[model samples]
Target: MQNQLIAFEGFDRVLNYGLDRLRCPSPVGVDRRIRLTQKVASIEHINATMFRVVLDSAIWIEDEDKPAIIASLIAQLHAAPDTT
Candidate 1:
């Protein structure tokens, strides 16, 4: 299985995106929004400091699309800094 790792400044944003996409309700969303997706399977850090988001099971993401999804997330995260 492949793992995707990401990081962000704020934790709330990351949590929200992950919960929303993963279709899992979490209490953490109520407090602070995660900024990014951090470690994956506690193996790779992805050099992230803010938030850690990982799409492990196939339920969360398709095996074929994993790479694309990861790339997109990374691109979006990098673009965010420029937009703001």
Candidate 2:
């Protein structure tokens, strides 16, 4: 199945902001960005073949932060138990 999708689960306030940012550049509080990056890496995928892309809202992450966050998420995805 090549059709893959990404999903996020977390506190409503945070998820709302994260989703919004993913859609477009939007303002987010520092605390929210910190929380998002911390949780982004822990995503467990139900399907193992698809690479999960969890991006932090563009408001806070700049320079090295973006790459670090992405790398962390990829690491977590690889470490996740294969469910498929």
lDDT for each residue of candidate 1 in 1-84, tens digit (9 for 90 to 100): 222333454333443333323433222323332323333342233444343344333222222222222221221122123333
The TM-score values for the models, in the order shown, are 0.19, 0.20
Error of 2 at 59 (Å): 5.0
Q: Estimate the TM-score for candidate 2.
A: 0.20
C-alpha local distance difference test of each model: 0.31, 0.33
Tell me, by TM-score, which candidate is best: 2
- Compute the lDDT for candidate 1: 0.31
Query: What digit string (tens of lDDT, one per residue) describes model 2 on residues 1-84?
Result: 101234433312222213322342343445453223333434444354323444432223343343222222232232334557
